[model samples]
Every structure is written in C-alpha cells, then in structure tokens.
Target: MTLSISARFAFETDQPTDVLLQFEAAAIPEQRIGKANTSLTQAEHCARVPAEDDIGERIWLRSQGRFDVEYSAEVTIERLLPDLGTLEALSPHEMPGEAVKYMLDSRYCPADSFQSFVEGEFGGTLGGARVDAIRQWIADHFDYAPGSSHVNTTARDSFIERRGICRDFAHVLVTLARASTIPARYVACYAPRVEPQDFHAVAEVFLADPTVEGGGAWHIVDATGMADPAFTAKIGVGRDAADVSFLTSFGPSNFLFSEVRVEKL
Candidate 1:
C-alpha cells in the first residue's frame, strides 16, 4: 500500500541569497510504503497538484533550500524502505559504526567527543542511538534563534555555542556521528506541511547488514524534525547540509529581507 500527500512551499531570506532546490530520493525509505510526484508553475511560486499511483503509505511533497535565492524542486518518494544495504557496503568510513579510524581522523569529530552517554546510555550504534542523542542534545541545549551563527559556523562552534538553527543542529549531529565511527552525511531540503516549503537539515548513518529491519541493512535518522514538531515530512539527505543547499549564486549581492512561512494546505 502507498499514501499520497500534496503541499505548497515558499520562503524569503533575510538577505538576497542564491538557493539550490532538491526534491529527489533514491527510493522509498524505511516504513514509508509508496511514491508520489509533483507539478509546479514555471516561476516556481506554486505547486500545481501532485499525483500518485497507489494510495497508502505517508506520501507527501518535500523540499530543501539555502541562501542563494529563488529556487525549488518537486520530488516523489517511491517505495519507502529502500535497499540501503548496497550503499552501506559501498560507502567508505565516512559515517558511523563502520570505522573508528576515519571517524577519529576527522578534525571535526574527535574521539573524546563521543561518550558512553551517547552509546551505552543511548542504546546501540550510530544507526541506533547516535542520531537520537544528537537530536535530544540539540533540542535541550540550543536555542531556536537565527543570526546566532553565520554560514561558516563549524560543528565545534555550534557545540560550544549551544544555540543555532537547523543547519547548526545538523552540523553538530554530523560531528558526533563521525566520532562514533559512523559514516554520516548531511542533507538539506524543505518540509511541506500546511504551508510552503522551508530549509531544513538532517544526518544519515551507514551500517552493515544486520539481518534485520526487512533488508540486510539500512540507513536511518532524520534530525530535521527531531528537535521541532514543525518539520514532519522528510525531503532529502547528503554528505552534509552544504551538499544539498539549493541556489548557488555566481556574483555578490545583498539581502533586503528574508522570512519563511509554512502551514499545512
């Protein structure tokens, strides 16, 4: 069975920003059963109406953006539980649970940073509790305020600051995940609910086939909505937020006023 959902996405930035919009998924992820597609106007202001073949699982429109400017992408999710085993086996020691060497080597994710409170206290490997721990920590420690940090805010900065937006939250998670020997990546996209799409962040962990979760193995964890209830729908994932940031402007510009409004429609 599959489910279908349609929504509109819109946003404004504080300054003139170039944006890169992504709305594509490798395949369905985890329990998310079916797939859906989208249609939009030429100007990319509105999402016409989405279409779906089967109707069952939680199907909805997702988007991602950055500071570039006006940008958007319409994506569909087909087959929620994708065969991540292949990717898991192929990915190097970039994420968690695969290798401590690479994780330790990373200047961003040091060995000391990962703690028992993250592993034993949390639960299993990065695939299990790592993502949750980061989410909980960010929610508990940080304050949801923009302008706290700029685009250059590093993982360490966010951790020490304990106050940032979605991008900062994702960087912190990525840093921690790497410390735990988990091959983690970054993702950026839009969360479409009642209103338009807005920028969001998340982390992904690569693990071997455990002979469980239906497939031989799978990658799990979406921190975008972990701290906040507003970001419900999943949109995209990558090596980091930078990889998925929409709108890459060529020249220099300035921002007049930027704002984002989202509501279920």
Candidate 2:
C-alpha cells in the first residue's frame, strides 16, 4: 500500500534556534520510498543525519525570526501481520545484541520499575498473546486525553493516571513487554485515519519463534487503536519517544502552529 504524508510547522523565535527534525519515512526493508520533499523558510546551516538502527533520517537546521517548514512524502509499505497464537517470545540469551537494548529500561519506558506487576499479570502468557493482552489492558484502563500527558510522563506515571496520548500508550506497552522479557520498541509513524491528524506512536515486538505458517518478524501494534499496521508508515524506532521526536530544538523557540495529514493512495 502507498501512503501520502504532509506536515507543516511554524515557530516564533526571539533570536535564533537550532532544530533537529525527524519527519521523513524510515528507510527500512519493509518500506520503499517513491518521492519526498522538504522546504524551510528563514533557515540556514542545514544538515542530515541517520538515526540509530537506520530507522529514519534527521535534519538539523538553524532558524531565525519567523520560521516555517513543510515536508511531504509518498511511500509504499509492506506489512506482514502474523497470527498472535503462532509466535513465541525469545529468551534474553537468544535475542540478538541489538534487540537486547529494547528489553532494558529507558527514560520513558522504565521496564525495571514495572517488573513486579508485569510478572504477576503476564508471566504465564506466551508469545504474541502476551503483547495483545498488554495492549488491551492499556486500552481498557487508560483514557485517551490529549493534554493529560507531557514529555516527562513515564510509563509508571501513565499507569497511575490512567490517561495519556499515543506516545504514553506506546511507552506503557513497551515497558510491560520488556518487563515480561519480550523485546519491544517504540515506533513513530504516520497513521491513516488518526483523529486530529497528527503523528502517531506505536509499538513493535520481535518474535523469534514461529509456527509453520507464521515467520519470525517485528509485529506492529497500536495501543491507541487508531492505526492499522498495513496502512501505517514508520518514521523511526527507539526505546521511547525521546529518541524519535519529530522536532527537537536546541535553543528556545515558541511553537506557533503545526499540522499533519496522511492519506492512502
């Protein structure tokens, strides 16, 4: 399936600010890019860098005065979602070195802190079923309130509050999976049919053992229940949202407005 994405960002600055942007689709094995373009106004000293794990590209720029930026892209993504019952979680020793980091605690996803609860709830559950249960548990308990969470909100806080946005949902799920000894990571993506039309957050679990009909793969899940795996376009992957923010400014800058749009083609 092909997806078209467009985003606009405006910032009002008193002096000058340096910004790091990660709005482009990831160059992963499952995604093929057709075309992409970006434009910046009142910006200079621009450069590009690849994100960790090759998940996406980041652009760095210096903006002065009233700054405006726009990005557009068209990409084709191939998603293979296997039956939940047909996959098995891999043991820590069996997981690859790269996957090991995801199983550990991060800034937003403090898996170690939730060890007791996760073990009590999902220790006996196996494979993708465990992940599905976690997702459902979050959806049933948490309220999807927009301003309920901030950048400093951690999984523990969200679990206690029972409310947050997509990133908070992803953080809690990621923490629960890691606490259950499953390798999971946070994903930033362009989600089709998302209410309010903004960048979306999702989670991916690495399944190491598979049934005859199901292969070992990274299965995507949206705890917010706002995205379909087949239609979502991945932008970046990280231990948590801290590593995949769409825009990070070094200097002080006030946000004027932002808009995002995604459509299936």
Candidate 3:
C-alpha cells in the first residue's frame, strides 16, 4: 500500500527560541519514501539529527518571530507480520540489550506499577496471546474521548478513567505489555484513516523472530484500532510519547494551529 502524508503547523514567538521537529515518515526497509520535502520559515539555525533506533531524523532549529513548518512525503509499505498467537515468548536473559530497556519503567508507562495487575488479569495467557488480550481488553473497556486526557496523563490515569486519545491508548498498551514481561515501545506515525485526522501513536513489542536463529523481532500493535500496522508509516520509536513528540520547544511560544492530512494513493 502507498500513502501520501502532509504535516503543517504554525508557531508564534516573542523572541528567538530553540525547537525540535520530528514529523517525517521514516525510511525503513518496510517503507519506501518518495517525493519527500520539508520547509521551515524564519529559522536562524537548522540541523538534522537521527532519531531513536535510527528509524527517522529530528530537525533542530532556532526560530525567531513567526515560524511555519510544512512537510510532505509519499510512502509505500511492503511489510509482512506474523500472527501474534503463533509467536512464542523469549526469556529476559535471551533479550537483546536494546529490547531490555523497553521492558523497564518509564515516565509515562511506569510498567512496574502494573506488574501486579497484569499477573492477576492475564495470568493464563503468555507471549503474543497475552499481548492480544491486553489490546482487546483496552478496546472493549476504554472510551475514545478526545479531551478526556491532558499532557501529564499516565497509563494508570487512563486505566482508571477508562478513556483517552490515541497516545493514551498506546501508553496503556505499552505499560500492560511490559508488565507482562514483553518489551514494548511507543510509536509516532501517520495513517490514512484516523478520525479527526492527526498524528498517531501505537505500541511496538519485541517478540521471537521466526526468521532468524535465536533472534527477536518487533511488531506494531494499535490498541485503539485506529491505525493498522500494515498501512501505518512510523516516524520513530521511544519509551513513551515524551520522546517522540512531533514538536518540542525549549522556550515559551504561542501555538497557532496544526494541519495534518494522510490519505491512500
């Protein structure tokens, strides 16, 4: 499948400020990029650096006065994912150094806090089955209320409130998966059919790599069921949304407006 994505946002500044931008579709083996371009206005200084896992790049800039950003790209996805039920789990000792950290606690996920809940709620299921169960549980119980959560919302908060946006759903999925001894990370991406049309977030878990010997693989899951892994184009991966937010400013700034469009081509 192919997708065309465009992300544009405006920011007003009283003075000069530093900003980090990360809203481009990643160029990985599974996704091919074409006709990609990005433009920044009023940037006194600008540079690009690699994002987490080298999946994408982040744009660092010094913006003065009013600024605007526009990014557009065409991406084709060629990926195949295994059935979660058929994939077996691997021991912690068998996990790679990179995967191990995802299983640990983070600011938003706080996987350790959910360990007891996981044991009680999903004791019978293991490996990918457990992951699927967690995803289904979230889908069945939570409400997709847009304004129900705020910036400081955590997985526990969402679990209790039983509602949140895409990022909140992703956070809860990551927390529950990690609590179940699965290494799960957060993902920022663009997908064709997300309602209200905005940047999307999902969870990616590390499981057995049936393709390689004694190796592990990462699979993407969307507890919100808003974005399908087969059609989603990732921006990057992080411990939580804090790490892969599309834009982060170091100083105070006024938010203007944002426009995001993703469509099948």
Candidate 4:
C-alpha cells in the first residue's frame, strides 16, 4: 500500500525568532519478524518527502526563541503490513514483572513514581479473565485532555492529576505493561474517532507467549479507547512518548501550538 500526506503550520511570533523545524520523513526500514522497526526520520526545517521504505510518516517544526507559533503536520502511512506470528512461548500464569523493571530503570523513562505505580497496579497476565481487567483498569483511571500537562509530567503524576492527553494515557499503559514483565512500547499516530485530522497516542503490547500468534509482534491498544480501525494511521513506536514525539526540539520551546490534518487524497 502507498499513501501521501501533508501538514500546514502557522506560527505567530511576538518578535523575530530563529527556528529549526524537525519532522518525520523516514521510510520504515525492513526488519526481522517479531521485532518492531520504529524510528524517526531526520527532517530539515521545512517540508519533507516520504522515504522509499516509508509506509507511515510524520512532520514537525522546532523554533529557537520565545514566541507564539502554530504548526500543523500531515502524515501518511500506507502499505498496511500484515502481522506475522512472532509471539514467544511463555506460561500464561506469569506476570510481566521483569518487563516493567527494565522500562522504569531504562533511560527511556526515568520517572520514579511511574515505576512504583506500574509495580503496584500491573500484577497480572494478559490471558484468560485478566485481559479485560487490564483494559478496564487503564480506561477507568485516566481522562483525555490534551495539553493539560507539560511533556515532563510523570505517569504517576498524570494518573493522580486524572487528566491528560492520549500520550499520557499511552505512557501509563506502556509503563504498566513493562512493569508487569510484558514487553510494551509507545505508538504515535492519529485516531479518527478522536478526530481523524489530528494526532494522538496509543500503546502496544508485545506478547511473549510463543504459542500465541504474533508473540513478539506489537498489538495496538488505546487506553483512551478512542480509535476507529478505519481512520487510524500509526506513525512510529518506542519506549515512551519521548521516543515518538512528532516534534522534538534540541534547545527549548515556549508558547508552542500544534495542529494536524490528515485526509484522503
């Protein structure tokens, strides 16, 4: 499959400011089965084109001064790839304790409160009656509110605060899954149900049971439960929100605003 995408950004500055725009533009590199190939494309300070291997893409901008800016990104991910069986074999009764430890201690996400919450709440397997329980637990705990907190907000804080965007919800889920000893990752993309023309966040769980289908493959889950299979476009994945933030800056940012528009053309 092939797709095309474009985004527009508008920034109003109180004063002239230096800007460095960085967006997603890399092709999905071919990878071995049972492993996810999610990485960011290095984009210059302007428009970008899809790479030869890209099935999905993203666009972003970074400015280097204090000013008001509005930016929009357009992304198209096509060539819907089928999931090949990659799940590993494991006992169904086991919890994801090991996975969680790695994630909290890992450099990807270092929030201490987040680590503790996962260890406390993530205490079961995904099979049998626990699957629904896991889903319900996530859904009941968080509310969807974009821009409620800065990116640095910890999962524990977001949970306590009880309000955040999809990224925060996804982060909590990813952390919980990992803490439970299950392999989980962060997914960045747009969910049509929430709003087709905007970006959102989702979590993916990687099952370790070989007997199950797609053992090591990623399974998309939305804590917000706000997606339609029809309009959701996945961009990339990583340990947490920090990994797949469509727009990342090297220095600092202030009074930032973002918009996204995705439509079939």
TM per model?
Answer: 0.54, 0.94, 0.98, 0.61
Better of 2 and 3 by TM-score: 3
Error of 4 at 99 (Å): 9.3
Give the Cα lDDT of each candidate.
0.46, 0.86, 0.92, 0.51
Worst 10 residues of 1 by lDDT: 51-60
- Tens digit of per-residue lDDT, candidate 1, span 1-265: 2223333444444443333344432233332423445443233232322211111121222232322223222333232344432333324423234232424423333435555545664455344455556656667777756778886777777777887777777777777766655656555434443222345566555565555442323244454354222233345444455445433333343334333333333
lDDT by residue for model 2 (22-121), tens: 8888878788888998887856678889996887889888877787889899989876666765578776777778888998999998888788997788
lDDT of 4 by residue, 13-110 (tens): 34333343333333343211121222222222444434211334444433333433333333344422333233342343443543343344333444
**Per lDDT, what order, best first?**
3, 2, 4, 1
> Distance from true position, residue 38, model 2, in Å?
1.3
Candidate 4: stretches off by over 4 Å: 1-6, 10-124, 127-132, 195-197, 208-215, 254-256, 263-265
In Å, residue 4's CA in model 4 sits off its true spot by 7.6
Candidate 2: misplaced stretches above 4 Å?
Answer: 209-216
**How do all the candidates rank in terms of TM-score, highest first?**
3, 2, 4, 1
TM-score, cand. 3 = 0.98
Residue 249, candidate 2: Cα error in Å is: 1.0
Question: Best candidate per lDDT, number?
Answer: 3
Q: Using lDDT as the measure, name the better of candidate 1 and candidate 4.
A: 4
